[model samples]
Target: MQARAAQDLKARMTDALVEAGLTYAGAVAHHTPRRLVLSVQGLLDQSPTLREERKGPRVDAPEKAVEGFLRGAGIDRSQLQERDDKKGRVYFAVIEHPGRPAAEIIAETLENVVRNFPWPKSMRWGAGSLKWVRPLHSILCILTADSGEAQVVPLDIDGIKAGDTTYGHRFMAPDGFAVTSYDDYTAKMRRARVMLDADERAGHIWQEAQNIAFSQGLEVVEDKGLLAEVAGLVEWPVTLMGEIDEEFLDLPPEVLQTSMKEHQKFFSVRNVQNGDSAGGIVRFITVANIETPDHGATILAGNQKVLSARLADAKFFWENDLRIVRDKGLTGMAEGLSDVTFHRKLGSQADRVARITALAREIAPMVGAKPDLAAEAAQICKADLQSEMVGEFPELQGVMGRYYAQAAGHDDGVPEACEMHYKPLGPGDTVPTEPVSVAVALADKIDTLTGFWAIDEKPTGSKDPYALRRAALGVIRLVLANGLRVELASTLVRPYHQNIRAALERHGAIPAEELNLPELSFDKVGLVERYQESKEGGTEDVPAVDDLLAFFHDRLKVHLRDEGIRHDVIDACLAMDGNDDLTLLVKRAEALAEFLKTDDGENLLQGFKRANNILTQAEEKDGVEYSFGADVKFAEVEEERALFDALKAADGAIKPAMEAEDFAAAMAAMAALRPAVDAFFEAVQVNAENPVVRRNRLNLLGQIRGICLAVADLTRVEG
Candidate 1:
């Protein structure tokens, strides 16, 4: 009964709109939300008249065309008003316009009605000169019954008129019928087997896919982007399960998945037990636009045929790639590496791999990896570049190499390293956990960074074409997450110099004799000295290692800032020497930040600041500087003796705590000195009349400086 009433109301609304010279577009009724949204397109075609009493001519120079366009759109002339130009575009405004529609309907109307306006990038095809993102098609305009019973809103664009009816899916739903309201329209469309909203269709597909996977004790790899695109291409989704040809199963699973996704848009399914098998039994699920009467047999067959052809190409590449691998023994793969450019300025992949191997060897001990194994892993991490599977699917570079390396009977770590090296590619990605893999991954990232920096190819303003920023972040995560103690500068500088030297040698620009000289030779020394001078002068001319370290430090702050560490804490930790051990540096920073939250830490900082300020003033005022011999005999107050004893105890405790990597313990030990420090300040004056006593006080302040500097450069900390 409600449906019939809605239908009757929709017919009456359509009739009224036609009589009033209006048009209708599309409409939707949401059930869960219990709302009716009527999408009417073309109401903006109306125009209003201008009055001579308001100003001069109703439409002036430059806006006459727009006024004429509005007049042709059916807008009343009396309500036309001109407004100020804000966007520098000449446009007239409508004031006190009587034909008002819902906000949603008006927004839709503006989009659909302005078809023939001159857009910056537009096309005119077939017969008309209408311009749009694509060619103009039929406009969907509709009106709901809830607005009013007798009223009709005018909506017209070009010559298309609004109606209260719409069609569904092209094949499954070919017929259109009248609808008196949005509710009736949605119901009829649903009955006709159509999902009007793209998101609804996507949700249905994913839910069905998950159901299928769950029934078989498997999981669906839900790709939101793929789901959205597929949803747009269909109206009604019907998932069909199919199988690849048994022969094609010999191809790597990644290859199979990539081929199906790229060429056929099919989702690859994995066997419940065989997660890593390349040639294991694989099932593919496909989403079709219709539910055929044949239960999707014909669709499945058609898809299987298409997939067979794609798999054949993949098989050919796999077989052919093995032949190349056998002949090349990894070196054959390196042949095309030169052509596979790392970056236009960073040379080839082979060159990069070589540099990476060198760096990995150097960084191995720092991360507790066997140097030889680290070098070996780095050398072949990119060997998959020679594989046909990787060539077909670039995203599967590391994954494909693992399979090929295993096939070649290489060490298990070698293949695993290949897979792990490009890891932590994103925020949620895992860092290489194994010692060998971590070493190689760090090496690979560092080499890329140093190479790019050497060529002055650093990232600028959102333009990091080389992914240098990600690589830097990966390096930080790998070190900190794995608790490695690598010196970033030592590891980065050698590779940087090596790459620079290689470039010079390749062009025959530098003499062979000069190249053979030690790294610290005259030429290298001169370069280092020049860099140091620039740095001292506050210029951006530091060595690549120093600059890269600074960049890494910035990346570290970004990484740790989210963990709630104060910016000052990071600065203080980084200002200390031996900060290249990123894991240790972060540990120290985190401990110190937590300690600073305590009352003892707060008072210690205050006392330290006070002592530092007074000492600085005295040093500046007095010509003579104080030295470190505190005269025990001249100690006039017990507070001074207590402070001296506290300093000795803190020095003894903090040194070992830091050496043991117990930063929390070190901070606690430093915290203990606060009370003694406060007492000394309260009980004694540093600027005493006796020269010996003043010197002793100055030395005590210097002792505080030394102790604080032991843990971190407290001077760099902000109050």
Candidate 2:
């Protein structure tokens, strides 16, 4: 945020300079929490004079038009110049602007930038019109020349004036000092016990903390985000390490770490040799902005007291939650979820959990997981949402679930699945590889997507209130990363039907049976009947399942775009049969993506396009498709006969290869036809004078289109 403030200053300053007809080479900034310092480099002393010519009405045009031109130009008719033109003659006016001094321009620019600065939050004080993130303290603006002469730019806003003096380290160096240049200002700031660079302050804090921890056998858990934030909060950092009280040491390491990091802004320290299982979190490192005579002994004492109190609360929550889990198990605790509304339109959290449980069992066999295990894992995965520990730290929802599951004596991947099912919370997060975890994870995300889509709550233009996009991407990653061959068109149907049925039952004025809605079931055979029937009837009662599938396709394109696979290539694969199978779709896209990079594939694309163009035009003209009856005996040239033989061979190889989902082999077969197709187009005229010969060549071109499309829709592939 400090860096963004500096950038905002630079951009506004640059715009002001442009408005004043002045220019600067560049800008440099050093931002601290309390101050933003920017230096404009290589600025012109004054703006250049501008000369412009303005065109006017024809000389012989209406008198009113001529008068209006002169009035708009702020010039007299005598100042106009007559110029010869094709349409007789025209009038022109010359306009010139005088230059303004750089000092004058800088003053106006700085004042405007300060007055209109964009802050995430700002306040006004002392009945002043000026608003700032903090109180307006001082302004230091100076222009240094090559000869070592410096002059302060004239600026004043709301009783604050620009000067060459600046104060540092509010408490330590309360006195103001003068500076002549940027280098001199920074050097003096260092002497005042102020660090001008945030990165330098962070580096100092980390290195000192590590050195202190290394003297013992402990290491600080690295959190760059916390480091940067702590760095921004201090102008001069002093590192101090403290030991946690022994009473709270036996608590979960995450509980200890989260308590310290969240409440005290301290970094957790753990024994490097013993790890979490043995040593646990024994210490914490804190950064203070000032050094006392006792070397932070007084500061550490106060912080330790506050930390112990916070950890005491955490310990109570943890013990209380564990006791509840031991007495009732996760299921008994999850009974409260029925009271928690997941969404007003789509029933409660318990209803959603039911849909996910059924979906997980249905998807278990496909992902190599036992139906009972997957269903059980899904049933209790979200049970900890009601726990006191999770209520205190919302980020530890799944993490706490894992611990409670273990306490409940659930095994066979159930304990791990409680935590791992929410795996891949982001793009950089790891994907779960366990079969039971994959089934539950896929079920969780699919239910979320289908539920929102059923309620007509689809994301629109930078607004996804439901996080549906992230859920869709999660589904895509789970399917592709696990190599799960899920036909999503059918997998999505059962949950979508359930989501619709549940929503209707909750809020519908009419019963579902009155509207001809079928009962929601997990029957594997013809599972898509409910979803498909609604779509085929073109009713607004339920959203199209294909629309949700297409959303997954959209996310897949974004997911593969970083792998250098083009959108059109994924579109080509998407246009083919069985596009609902994300694994197969990506495999074909990857193969075709690699093929299009090779010489054979590139040339084959051109040949296929050429044949398709000719065949389409002929079909349009003849009012019939030339898809069959291309007899080898009717070939009028050797090139035509050779092309027919190549198509036949490619078809023979590609059919079986595509059936086996061996996309590489199918693409290779398609590449073999490039040479024959190219040679035939070169030797034989597709639009021959003889009708029978022309029809035969058109049918042969149709053969090229058919065989090439068998691998992927070449028409969707762009050059």
Candidate 3:
């Protein structure tokens, strides 16, 4: 919030200055915990005077129009100049704008900025109408001249006048200090026991903490976010290391780190030799704003007392959750999930888990995982949601699940899968490499996408309340990164049909056993037909799986485009069959993208487009499709006969290469025809005077179109 507020201040001030017709070379904002400072360099003393020519209506235009133009230009008819336009004579008005002094504009802009600053939360105190993030103490507004003279900008806001004075270190140095410029101000702030830059403060805190920990043969567990927050909380930082109670050292390292950081703003210290193997978080470091007479010994005593109470509560939750996991396995702990609703349209969390389990089992063989293990892992991945430990710290959901699964003595992969399945949460995050984890992860994301898509609750524009876009991207990443060949067209149908059936059953719109529905195809038309056969309702109830598949294609385009593959290349590949297999689709797109960069591939594309255009136009004009039967006997030119032989040889190679999914080889074979096709078009005319020759030439173009389209829809490839 502080950083954003500082940025907003800079932007708003710059806009105001520009509006006042003043120009500055550059501006910068400095954000600290208690202050936002803005400095503009190379500021102009005053704006330049402006002279503008305003065009008005023609001389013959309506009287009312001419009068309105004159009034808008703020000029009389005597001052207007007449010019001969192409249409008729026109009027032009010369207007001049006077500039204002910089000091006057700066005073007004500063007052306005202070009065209307944007804050996430603000408070009013002492019967003052002015609201601020906290009680306003003082304002520092100074203009330093090039001659090293400092002058305060004249302004008053809510009875507080602007000045060039600032105080620092509320406890250590409460006296106010005045400075001439930014450099002097920062130097004096340091002497006053304050740090002016947030980044510098963070760096200092981290280095001192690390040095203290290393001196004791320990290392600080680094958390950048916590370091930043602690830096913001102090101006003069004094790092102190303290011991943790041995009673709580047996807890998990993550739990200890999370507890200390979240509750106390403390950095965990780990033993260098032990690491995080068993119990490594034996000490913690805290930052204070002032130096103490006794070197923070009394402060550590007080903080340790408070920290012990917080850890006692954490210990209680951990012991209670473990006792339940010991009494009943993780599955038994998850039995209550049936009462927890996943969504209003969707069923309970238990219902979602069931769908994921089934999908995981179905996807197991394709991803090279055992069906039983994948199913078992998916069944209990969310069991930790019901544990007491997770209730207090929700971010520890999957972390606790892994521990509980291990305690339950599940398989090696199952325990790991419990935690790893939620991974790749972002583009920077890692995806699971274990087979069981991969199967469960894919199943989880696919079910989310299809289920929401089934209920007509798809994401619209930027409002993805259900994160459907992330789920789709997750599926794409999982497939492409793992080189998996599971076809999404079929994989998405079963879960979608299940969601539709569940919704219908909940509404009593269809009887469960009476439906006896067949497997719905990936296309929406097939789903509509299946629904019509079962009931009289319209297609509105049918899930648009084809549209969902298109959504996946859109996300895949974005994903591949980030890797330097063009969107048009992806669109060309999407036009082909088996685009549902993202791995195959991306491989073909990558090969085609590489191919388009070459001279042969570029010439081939042009030739294919030329042939396709001629064939399309001939078919439209003649009202007949000439798709085949291009006889070499009617070629009439040597280039035409060579193209015929080249087409045959290319077809033999491309067919097998395409079958083997060697897209590079297929593209290479297609590129070999570029010279032949270009020569034929260059030497022969398709619309010949002889009727049979013209028909044969058109048929030859059709062959070119067919062969190129077989590799990929080159017609969709853009220049």
- Among the numbered candidates, top TM-score falls to 2
Kindly report which residue stretches of model 2 are placed more than 4 angstroms away from their true locations once superposed: 55-93, 274-279, 494-499, 506-515, 521-543
Pick the winner on lDDT between candidates 2 and 3: 2
Tell me the lDDT of candidate 1.
0.70
Model 1 compared with the native: what TM-score? 0.75
Candidates 1 and 2 compared by lDDT, better number: 2
Worst 10 residues of 2 by lDDT: 518-527
Segments of candidate 3 deviating more than 4 angstroms: 51-96, 274-279, 495-543
Which candidate, 1 or 2, has the higher TM-score? 2
lDDT by residue (tens digit), candidate 2, 1-719: 89789889988998889778878888887788778988887888899999889999998899999999999999897899999978779999998888988888899888989999999999999878999999989999988886778899988888899999999888888799999988889999988889978889999999999999889978888889899999988889999999899999888888998889899999988887755434578899999988789999999999999999999999999999889988999999899999999987777899778878887887788899999999999999999999999999998889999999999999999888899888778777889989999989988898888777666689899999888888888888898998988888765654465546655654673365544454445444233555666556554454356788778888889999977899999899999999998999999999999999999999999988888888888788889999888888889889988988898899999999999999999999999998898899789888889888888888888888888888899899997
Each prediction's Cα lDDT score? Answer: 0.70, 0.86, 0.85
Per-residue error (Å), model 1, residue 495: 5.7
lDDT rank order: 2, 3, 1
lDDT per residue as tens, model 3, 526-585: 332444544543223334668888898999888888899988888999999998989999
Error of 1 at 461 (Å): 1.9
For candidate 3, the per-residue lDDT at 93 reads 92
For model 1, the stretches where C-alpha displacement exceeds 4 angstroms are 1-109, 112-131, 136-153, 157-164, 177-189, 196-200, 216-219, 222-224, 273-281, 338-347, 495-499, 502-506, 509-542, 621-645, 676-705
The positional error of residue 37 in candidate 2, measured at the CA in angstroms, is: 0.9
What value does the lDDT take at residue 421 in candidate 1? 93
The sequence of per-residue lDDT tens digits that candidate 1 reaches over residues 1-719 is 22232333345444444444455564222211111133343333433333222222334455676566566545655555565554342434343334434433443444443553334466666755556545644444443444532223344544545455556667787787766644566788788777665568779988888788668766566567777667656667898778778898767777887888888888777776546433343788899988789989999999999989888988998888777777676656757787887765566888688767766776777778888888888888898887877777788889877777776667848778888999789667888899888888887887778777766789999899989889999989998888776666644554345446556556554565544322322223333343354345554323556777888999999888978898889999998887787888898999999888999988888887887777778778886554366656678899988888899999999999988999999999999999899888888998888888888888888788678778887776777
